[model samples]
Target: MPNQRYTNQRNTEAPMQSSIENLSRAIFTVNRHAKTAPDPKFLYTLKRQALEKLLAEGKATKKGLHFSKNPKNSRQQSDVLVSAGEYFFHLPPTKEDFSELPHLGELNDHYRNPKANMSLSVAKTLLQQYANYYPTEDKKQPGKKTYQKPIFKRLGESY
Candidate 1:
């Protein structure tokens, strides 16, 4: 007879695997768009938050650090490497990361994230839900004035 416990475990594993796969694909899509996006703040934030949540849940693991390819101001820098499912990502390193994770030196140019077929909208939605992020609109108050025309007076004229 088939073991009941084994069957139940197998059933549970399937869903977990699919969810992880979906999350990885969503992350890939978000990252790809963020690179060329005019305003990528929200996209990047979603990716970071989702990865952090996955790390906290043990669904992702930190591999180490890698030298940033495009360091700002031409200064040497590094990023924390994280692995989720079959994909890898980089996050800004913390102080503790310097002492904890080993430095992996330069990033490998030959390696690339797996191709993801998900649409940008779908990926954004999935990440927004997973990361529990709701973007706040920067709407101006109806009664608030953003600018005012300066009053001009000729010569030394005064009221």
Candidate 2:
């Protein structure tokens, strides 16, 4: 779940500046998966709206993003900030990229968990690490087929 601090109180309006910061951190964390997927799914309509709006505000950056205060308004039906770029619709899924629902559902699922939220900069670094860890190792087929090694694909390695 997202930090309750981000929640809106019925009678009190939280300070905007601090709320914005909280929203930033929260949004970044939630979008971490979006940054790391082999082929990112950034096609959601809401994400695109957020991205364009932030870009217009000159707030878009490789590591930083602008977010709405209470995103629930659109989803849970509450007035909340949806992170910028939260709605850029991705091209329709294809066998070439993936076989699934529209990018909107993909991005939404990534950010569905509050734990998913992490600062964009941190998320980017973490994603890079994950990619490096599971690099596509080169593979050489033996005269005969075999699949016994955990690291099955690599140069000059026998299974």
User: Each prediction's Cα lDDT score?
Assistant: 0.88, 0.37
Model 1: residues >4 Å from true position, as ranges?
1-18, 139-159
Candidate 1, pairs of clashing residues: none
For candidate 2, the C-alpha RMSD (Å) to the true structure equals: 19.3
| True-structure Cα RMSD, model 1 | 10.5
Q: Give, for candidate 1, the lowest lDDT window spanning 10 residues.
A: 9-18
TM-score against native, each model: 0.77, 0.22
Which TM-score value belongs to model 1? Answer: 0.77
* Candidate 2 residue lDDT tens string, 1-159: 565466453423332232334434434553554556564543122233443444456554332122322454465221122333332222222252223222222123344433333445443333333223222336554577676867556888776
